[model samples]
Target: MNIFADFEDRVRKAVEAILKARETALPDLSRVAVEPPRDASHGDLATNAAMVLAKPLGVKPRELATEIAARLARDPDVATPEVAGPGFINLRLEPGFWTGHLAAILKAGGDYGRGRRTGHKVNVEYVSANPTGPMHVGHCRGAVVGDTIANIMAFAGDTVTREYYINDAGEQVNVLARSAFLRYREALGETIGEIPAGLYPGEYLTPVGEALKAEFSDRLLAMDEAEWLPHVRDRAIDAMMAMIRDDLKLLGIEHEEFFSERTLHADEGGKIAEAIEDLRGKGYIYQGTLPPPKGQAPEDWEDREQTLLRSTEVGDDQDRPLVKSDGRYTYFAADVAYFREKFERGFEEMVYILGADHGGYVKRLEAVAKAVSGGAAQIDVVLCQLVKLFRDGEPVRMSKRSGDFVTLAEVVEEVGRDPVRFMMLFRKSDAPLDFDFQKVTEQSKDNPVFYVQYAHARSAAIFRQAAEVGVRLPDFPTLDASVLAGLSDEGELALIRKLAEFPRLVKAAAEAKEPHRLAFYLYDLASAFHSQYNRGKDFPALRFVNSENGMITQARLALVRAVAVVLETGLGLIGADAPEEMR
Candidate 1:
């Protein structure tokens, strides 16, 4: 199905065989590569080995190229391999080569560019929002990015696990418990005055408190603070987590694991403590006096000796504290334990999708995961920058019941999952994005989600249009490989060229671990199809529906069908829908 890879393999072996047959010492072939020409005039593929080996061989690049091209002429897949521009081998494929790609596309259909699964297990963690509130707009980018990355990794052969880490055991949960306590009092028809400063003021929690009031009522009020705090915190945390899960599901994101921070240390009589102690045993932790912070230090900064990690040795700005002065483990301590648990679960590759504010934490956490896994596990943190919402070229007002925040459910309801996903991936993971609420639903090229979907719909429309004209489109039901040989138009050949580049594209994208490339590829493929579609308007004979000539119609229909297949395949990779009808 991957003809480019197949041809590249053939050419590689032929070159090596030709070299050995010439009785020349074998040069290292590791750096050699096969890639398409940026300009089509440069031929189908271009390689640089001849140019690279020219200086070492003490011969002009053209002379060496002539020698290599002479040897490559005998290969069946390559019709001609010409050396141009200082020994660049521009291989022009046979006439059947471009046309024959339709067979592979029809054979593979929706699975055309799907790569082999790596079989290596990986855990991807994202949207580990505090279990004290619903997911807001900030979660949308990470949710879509993480979900798409999981899909891409899975498609590329890795065993991917989507995980949602719930930080339900922290101080935030206790604060939420106290915040819910006030709402509980209010639900009992008792005025608790204005919601105090430093407490959650969002009205969304009113129902949570109302639910708690119905469940426990006067019982919690009568109980001691110690007894009531845990009950309230646990109930409130579960409610918030339920809201987060529902929001994610609305965005079409599903995680395999909902890991709890509270579960780690509670699993074995304080496992977090055990992990820290183990690190202490390994000389990774130490009590040291740290200097005052630089670059806008905290206002409450105090220089004192406390528990610290040897993070400086692992390439951090400085050693960070693992425990506070009150003998409580700092956030870094829990982080170390979290990754330790990730490794304990037998995952060697861990990826975390976090907001851009965590840029400072990336190096330290990567160093920690590497240290704790004993260099056995590696962590990749993909930081998603902020998403600025727009409407009519102006920032839209967002309300999450708080004055400023917008929930994930709001965006999902506003623009469904496809636009949300495609918009998020339309930019690099590290770049800030402008998401226009109004434009996403538009039917023009301004919206890539709509444009790509329209291309697939247009292809399907061609079939229906052909049928209406009594032009019976071929069903790819025959083995007449000779029928494909009829295609020769420049635009037709251009579409074939894009179709043939798919396998190499997938491999390159996988090797780079960047799913945004897949999005760009879909756009380029759609552009080619649109270009060809417009060209057919000027040249009536180039139209795919040739009722008079069945073979030409079949050949062109086969080509567009191949376009749809590749579109669906690429769209599926980035978690976007390939709709057959735009409306």
Candidate 2:
């Protein structure tokens, strides 16, 4: 049970008493939201309920807090409630209530920390990187966030599908084709010179070239660019996509779909046409001149009327063009069709995980989705900022030209997938991240990945030690929740409080679309675990494995297992492995 929720019920009762006594007028209770104080010394739970209602009811905040506290003291669960610093109600949970939290922890286990599911259907689209190249560090952050979001959505009871949009029929693919053709020539036993400046220069393309040689070695030699280009392009794309899939597997990230952009325009006319037709029926599309982007407009800019969506009618900064001057659909046009397809597929909501460079696109995309769906579908587009690499405190060089930038595979190989995933999410998504190759690989407590993993390991170690003490630790590890009713140590109570907040924390972070929140929470919980473990070294009685008392050992071990479950569940949500032991 959520202690914060229980206290909220108490506060509501106190307010009802105040209203019944005619001491205060009915205040709007909508503003009532209880939260744990940032500083633990500020008390177990803090609320601004008195301050929120005081002015409306014509009373001072501290006075109102004192009144609320006096009435709330009647609650059996609360030892005392006091007014502190201008109206904050510092709730002190009763000893029995705090001690009983151990039972809650034992009862919850892995399911303890999971949030309630909303049953809302959503589509989480991410890592839509081009299939023309290997998965690199640039794609890592968004992929992790998106994958975690899908898992989080599942935990929250929403029907979720992980999707990857493949840019198969784009200008970039044409370039990839030409680059692969050079490899194809080399594969066909031709002594080709240095690869062209505009083409891909990676040795990874060697296989794509070899495949072409195997497939159409003789026929392509006789044909010129016109006949061979299309065949070469299609074959090369399929090869590159295979490489991308392999690279993603290294990081344990997978997608439920690999939707082709070509399918949007092939066979049955085009999805762009369908989307535009739907928009036209709703009167959103119109022939109008778009304002040139701020700062610097293109030199070739011409102020000619063109079909545009009235994006400003929603919340976009300016109206955007759906078509370029060359009478071709823009990428924005394609995105509109993609989003429309998502809604047509029956998603109640959708999330787009994009790189930070796409931050400016959030508003326009959200606006269009709302406009197109007639306010039915909601899309949240999150932009992940850049990750700057460091090695021994120096910046690692990154080059887009030579493919010298770090790949996600390289990072996962250098440091395991758990560290990479956890470190990538250690900060807010929009915030820039500094990933140090040296720091992550280091085996030290400063490394949160190792520290957190060590806590889990220590918990397991405690179970082992207890088992050696002649205590009958269950083989399958089932604890009776009722037996944990007498746990009263500060460390045990603090851990219980932290463990009991998992479900609430999960729901908050999931609702906020802030996966970093999970990372932060894990760090705090790990710190708590570490502190408690270290305390056992100083105070023998406080140790998890108490050989002198079998019942105490069982109950304490139960609490330790509860901590491990929460840690495992949280790490699992973010695609990080909870090591049974850390090397």
Candidate 3:
């Protein structure tokens, strides 16, 4: 029931009939598209059929537009089809069309905007924060963006797998192990003074230390560093990941897969060796020396030959190293193996939600997907920019729990999950976001989450008011267009049009891998609904409830219920809630 898609078919049919009557060969209709007009006042829907087909048909643009508009004007659902500037066709649908669609919305309810399954397996990897400490605010935007993208993708008909790559094999985890060892020593009654430099100072590790003391006691004390390091590191990673999971759960995020980096390095670098060998077989790997980076050479840049991936041949800026001069596999090697593993797992598309700082990895990652799958799979990288926290226009920094940065849990705790999740997505991910603690919690239209949720609350209140007036609304299953014929008001039809945009919005946002669009659409829908509600205040006949007339009241109630359904479905997709009552 996508009106735009439906009309696109109708417009194409009209063109085909016109061509048949003129004895003209048919032109490609794929380029033709039907969409909402940029300005609502122009018309309800706009199309470029005539403009796209005119050159091929050898007809004047305005002439073809006129012919198409005349045919569309014959449709019972179309009130008018006018030829606008540059041969675009603007259509205003009949009142029955809008009111009928409103009934369809109620019948569909939660499933109204759901898409048909595409049978595409998409792997969305997001919020792969290192398992070294509790998740901080720096990871919040990517987390919410990734989770919401997964939600939208699933709703958009892709078989989406939510994944998190655990970065537990790096030197950072080793540092965490050593830091936890210090806490372990303190837990054993050893008067270790201040936390030494180059070690984590956050008290979150205190519990990890206590847990180790309870498990291994003084046994670790006698063991050499080499013998105790692995035991302590594994334990510390588990503790940190547990804390991280709890923090994510507070924001309603959970990954279906948590692929550990250690697995790739297991069996004495088994997976990495296989990945390198595969690349070598494909002639994508070779021993080479990379030129010094542009402008200046990094300190770690070595002039000696090293094992490298021919990434530049596949679109990377330069060939990337697979193994260092020291004979240890580089971090890029692990990434290559991880991608290969995902490819072998049968994913047709891989989506990476990364921080803005990782922009450099985009081309190289795309190269990896190309080489690993031989262009059989696609890769998309979404980068989220930094979020600056403020309170009443003043910057707020530092968290006692995380020592230097604010923890994700702290942000969610301070403002609640709904505000944190909605506001995180209120802006495009590529743009920097300024999150104000006080502003998001305000119970006014200035607060987007509150405003949207308040719309749902108001809808609920409308039903209660209808009930008090002795107007028993018809059940959705029994409601039909006949009951909705009273909804001929311009504002009511406008609200219905906004609701009608949901399916198209969901499809577009999911295809673009931009969940922020959903937030924007929800806000727009809320504004339309609130405007209609306010209009009722000035015009008594425009009110949702008319105690003196039950028929129109039922029709209006159906419209309000449709709004509630859409608001709930959209909020759920973004990992937020739609409350029936704001208070």
Candidate 4:
């Protein structure tokens, strides 16, 4: 149902046919693209094919344009092919052509905008939240972005693996273990006062402490630090991960794999050790002294010999340390092993959705992917900026339970899940977002999620109203395609044109790795639908329901249904519900 794609194919064939007729060798035609003209008055579609192929064919663009235009004018679907502006081909499609595109939409239904199989296995790792506590508002953006990307890539026919890398092997989890132990002691009648500095102070872990007390009682109290730490740490991480999963569930996000950083050290044959050895074999591993990091005086920094990876050779800003002076693998080293594991499992395309704070980790991890896979795999990192929550115009109060940041559970419970998911995606991931509590909840057109949802609900309401008035929809297969062709009103044509852009929009968003583009497209489509609906208020004949003429009403209902189909598909891709009724 991609009208633009169909036109591009036709244009390519037309040019190739002309080349064959003239006995000229065809050059690469990949850059020859057909897109909608900027001004609707210009035409339905435009192509730069003549300009791109002219030099290769040894002719002026206008000469080739005349030949291509003549060939395309003969197409049954194309009403007129005119040469416009220095060899650009402007095509005006017959009204019947749009009806056929609409029929394609009905035939495909929810599968309307999906792409053909690309045969690429993609690993999308996001929300690698430390298994320290429940996910906070800060983690929500990356979670939604990553999950939406996985969904979009899958829609584009890529085998997508949604992954979460649990940071359970780090010092943060050790702090979590100690924090849980305090709660454990508190459960056993020891009054542990205000949480000490350098430890997690949230009250959420009080339950984790109570659970530990219920499971082991005083048995763990008798063990030495080294003996009890691992047990408590493992239990704490498991509980935190469970809490995090529950929070993610509230937003409809579920990862296919919860990869453990601890596994890199524990996996048979030591994956971290093997990864380092593999790099060393390639001469990428070396003992080196790094220049003191920027902004620090040389006297203030300690120069130490360390195991470093030749990350600069693979496009990193500088060589990165693989192992610290104390012999523990740096965080980057474990990331390398994890990437290698994914690459070995047959995924060459890796996408990481990280927060803005982790911007520095981008190039190093990309370098790791290239080095570990021997240039066979590459990583794309999307950095999500901060989200500021507002109630009307003022900032929302911080959660007392979360101590500093608001918890994802609180936001979901306060606003419900749909707003949280949709509003999070309402803006690009790299831009800072201000999510207003009152505005998103408002039923007016100011709220994008509400507007899109209402467009869907209105489409359903049209059917219900039509059925109430004893007007049943004609069977799609039995209906005359000419019924839809009668829709020649400016508003009707505008909506159909927007609907025709869905497949192209989906492919563009998926290829650009920007799920927010889909969200914006849905908003635009909703705006067009709303505008058309409003137009009927002033011009009664433009209304979707007409008792005097059931044929015209049925055709308009067909258009409404198509709008719902595309809206539902787009919302589903971004993990939001397309409600039949908005309460």
Candidate 5:
């Protein structure tokens, strides 16, 4: 159960009761909130009901706070409700409340913080890197962020669909085909020279070339460019996509759907035409001339009239072009069709996890959702900033396989999947992050991944130590409440307080679409657990396994087990592992 949410409801009800007794109209309660006080010393929970509602109710802040405090003091779980500052109310819960919550945690185990299913369909599209090459470090952050978002959203009760959009119909695929054709010729013992400057130069395509050689042998060598281009392009896209999938699997990511962009252009551009017609019927499509560039005009500036989508009528900065000067549908047209397809599939929300470079596409995408869905659906774009790799303080620039950038597989191979996934989410997705290879792999508290996983391992070690001491921890199902009476130590209570925040934390992080918050919260929880363990070392009475005292020992073991359960659940949400042993 979310104690904060529970208390928030109680606080609101308390105010409503106060209003009812006075025969006054109840003010809006939406602004009222109950949360853990910023300073633990203040109290267990704090609320701003008095401060936010006093003016609307025509009452003084402190006067209203005193009234609310008196009403809240009636709760059996609230030990004391004190009014502090101007109008804030701080609540100190009874010690039994924490221990009882710890029992609830054990009862719930891994499902302690999981939300009730809402069944709202959500499509999260991430790591849609063109199926042209292996995934590079440039795409790693968005991949992890997107995957974690889907995981947390599912845990928070939404129906999540992990998706990858393959840009296989683009000019880049044609370039890839030519690159593979060069390698194919080389594979056939033809004296091919160095790759052209415009073609992909990575040797990763060498395998694709060899595959084509095995499938068609020298027969492809005699075909015209027009005849063989499509054959090579399709094969090359498949090979690149296979490699990309393997790379994603290295990070524990697997999309439920892999959407091909080519399908939108199929049936003689039927889908794109349909989307345009739909928008046109709704008065969103028209022929127009775009204004010139704001600053010094670029070399390609043209003022000719073209088919356009009146995106500005919705929310975009400008009306967008639907067709290029060459009469082919523009990329924006494909985006419209793609969004329409998703809406038709019954997705209420579409989340796009894109690289920082795609920040300009946000408004246009939002306009598309509004126009095509007729305001029935919405789109949210999350941009992941660049990740700069460092090896022991020196910048790492090149990869042997990727040529210009580090491959995601190379990063995972060097450090490991857990470290890469956890560290990628260590910073806010929109902020630039510097990932130090050495620091992340270090086996110390300074490394967040190690620090958090060590907490789980330490809990396991506690149970084992208890067993060695001939103290069999009682099963949660049969444990008695009296067994937890001796768990009144400040350190023990503090850890429970931290554990109590998990459900609230999960809901907040999921709603904000910020998985980094989970990473930070897990670190804080680990710190609280580690601190309590260290306290036991200094004072024998605070130890988790007190063989001489069976009562307190059972209580502490229950706490340790709860910590391990929460750690495993949080780690799973972030696509990381909670190891039972650190080594």
Candidate 6:
């Protein structure tokens, strides 16, 4: 399945054999990589092991490449090995080797490309949208990206926890409370005037107001702002979170935990104070005045002494204040506490999915991770770029219902969740995506999701035809690899090679924390499948179900079934549907 890994081992053994033959010392070999050739014409695989080891052994790269190639040709799986330019060793595997890969895939079923267990606890925080309003389209990209990353990490063996951080303790929630109170008065037959400025004016708060009115009739109207704010704030936050969760469900996303920012401010052994104390004892905390940031006039800044974290020592651009001049904990302070909570709960790896606006926060967050974990834990931040929704090449300016920007729910309703999620992941997370409504909903091959899903559906249709034609294909496991000997067509071989690359592709994408690679891989695989299917139209003998020759048909059927399994598994990871038939 992981042919690259298998060949890498073979290359390593060949190097060891050469070292033993010469009885010479060698340097580290961990960096030696056996990968696919840049040009497929070179070979099935290429390795730079000889070039990497040559200098340490005091030999020319070409000489070392020759020695490695000679030893590699002895491998039963390796049909040919040659030394190419710059000491690259290119290898082509035996046809039976790729054929056996089909068997491996069939045996594993949906789990064919997944990696072995790594036993690492990873916390992935994404789409922590403020619980003050319905989720808009702006939140869609980060939500899909984070969810896909968590899914890929789990498939690639890490224990993943999907999390959302609620901004409940912020001033925005107070504004939400005020917005709801106005709606509450309206619910009780009070004619409240136009919503005041600097407060939430969205009509989504009307229901929250109705709910408050139902609970206490008019008692809340008699209380002071301070007395009534907490009651309204909790209810509004709960209502907003419920709405957000429903919106996320439309896209098939559900976080395992929704961590509240309020939890960090608990008076009994407060986490914020505790986190600060932990850092203070470690000598990374100080009280000081910071210099004005670059390019800013001194008059434009207000200098004051405050509690600060020595984030500069851990690679941050400057020291960060943990408390504000107003005697309230800063946002960074809450972030540190939340991070410490996750760390104490046994997460060794932390991944943050943020928007482009939060790019400046990466280094400081990484610094906090280092300070809290003493460099034992790792932090990775993925800053998702903007997404511009377009319709027929023109940008969509507003949403009819929200009257501001398009809500994520509205987008899902327009084109369906499959298109929304797939198109969002069709590109890398950090790249700005142009989501065209007309293109994604198209039923043609131009749509990547449709093309990939059609591949699975086409495989199913082929099996149905196979049954109708009186050619009973054997179970996938019973299809002997030897039967594939009849499949000598270059197209068939190339398709098989692509299928064999799935395991390696999954590993590479997961290690890089980039799930978009899988999307691209599925599209490429679908193109190959579609191309091979089209070839059968010109050459009838290349058809998958040859009624007169059941053995070969059975072998091809096995390959088809494996492709369906992989396509279904891949679509599921990215939260897209792999339909049995296109609608």
Provide TM-scores for the models: 0.92, 0.94, 0.97, 0.95, 0.97, 0.97
Writing each residue's lDDT as its tens digit, candidate 6 over 222-247 gives: 99999999999999999999999999
Mark the regions of model 1 whose C-alpha exceeds 4 Å error after superposition. 21-27, 51-66, 267-269, 277-283, 298-302, 312-317, 324-326, 397-403, 473-479
| Residue 339 lDDT (model 5) | 95
Question: What CA RMSD would candidate 5 show?
Answer: 1.6
- Check candidate 3 and list the clashing pairs: none
**Better candidate number, 1 or 4, judged by lDDT:** 4
Clash-forming residue pairs, model 5: none
The TM-score measured for candidate 5 stands at: 0.97
C-alpha local distance difference test of each model: 0.80, 0.81, 0.92, 0.87, 0.92, 0.88
Summarize candidate 2's per-residue lDDT along 454-491 as a digit string, tens digits. Answer: 88888888777776767887422445545676577888
Worst 10 residues of 5 by lDDT: 297-306
lDDT of 4 by residue, 64-115 (tens): 8999999998999899999988899999998888887887787788899888
RMSD of 4: 2.3
Candidate 1 lDDT by residue in tens digits, 32-101: 6667866788788777767777676567878877877777787766788888887788888776877777
Alpha carbon lDDT of residue 175, candidate 3? 87
**How accurate locally is residue 207 in candidate 3, as Cα lDDT from 0 to 100?**
98
lDDT of 5 by residue, 1-583 (tens): 9999999999999998999999999988999998989999999999999999999999999999999999999999999999999999999999999998898898898899999999899999999998888898888999999999999999999999999999988888998999999999989888777777788889888999899999998999789999999999999999999999999999999999999999999997899999999999999888878898798864434588778999999999988888766678888889999999999999999999998988989999999999998898968899999999998689989653335778999899999999999999999999999999999999999999999999999999999999898998789755777787678998889889999999999999888899999999999999999999998899988899988888889999998998899999999999999998989
Considering TM-score, which of the candidate structures 1 and 4 is the better prediction for this target? 4
Answer with 1 or 3, whichever has the higher lDDT: 3
Residue 315 C-alpha lDDT in model 1: 65
Report how far off residue 170 is in candidate 5 (Å): 1.1
TM-score of 2: 0.94
Candidate number with greatest lDDT: 3
Which runs in model 3 stand beyond 4 Å of their true positions? 56-59, 296-300, 399-402
List ranges where model 4 is wrong by over 4 Å.
Answer: 55-63, 267-269, 297-302, 397-402
